[model samples]
Target: MLQIIVAMMLFFVMMFGIGFILNMLMKTTWFPIYLYLIVLLPLGIYYTWDDSMNFAQNMGAYTIVDYLPAITALAGAYISGTAIRSLRRGGYKMF
Candidate 1:
């Protein structure tokens, strides 16, 4: 519904902006994606995991509504990295 669309956009913009800033400050191309995959994802899953459900069942419980925002956020992180890489290739030293 409208809420899902809004959440997806919000997550995408949040990730993009944060990743952009982090890349600029840390001078790293893909760190934000790594951070998202390695840190944020695990924490989120762990926090939401159900003790009664098996791993597969728990994972399978996520619908398109639940996954869309995460997918968009990941896309945002990847795009930010590509943007920084292009900027570096274009000879912008600060980025």
Candidate 2:
């Protein structure tokens, strides 16, 4: 549906912008990926966790619409790191 596509694009753009800024500030290429894995991923899981439901039930609740946004966000994080790395390699000292 249109909503799913919108959500995916929104998540991707938000992650990319945040990651880009973080990379510039931290001067690290891969920090966004670590932050996404260590922080965002666990927080998302915790938010969706259900005490009454079994692990399988909780995990099975996710559909393509849910997973797509996550995938796009992760891709955004990775691409942001690559972009920074490319800039650094290209002799862009500001990046």
CA lDDT, every model vs. true structure? 0.94, 0.94
Off by over 4 Å in 2: none
Off by over 4 Å in 1: none
Error of 2 at 6 (Å): 0.9
In candidate 2, what are the lDDT values of residues 1-95, reduced to their tens digit?
Answer: 99989999998999999999999999999999999999999899999899999989998988888789999999999999999999999999999
Error of 1 at 21 (Å): 0.6
Task: Find the candidate with the highest lDDT and give its number.
Answer: 1
| TM-score (C-alpha) between model 2 and the true structure | 0.95
Candidate 2 lDDT at 61 equals 88
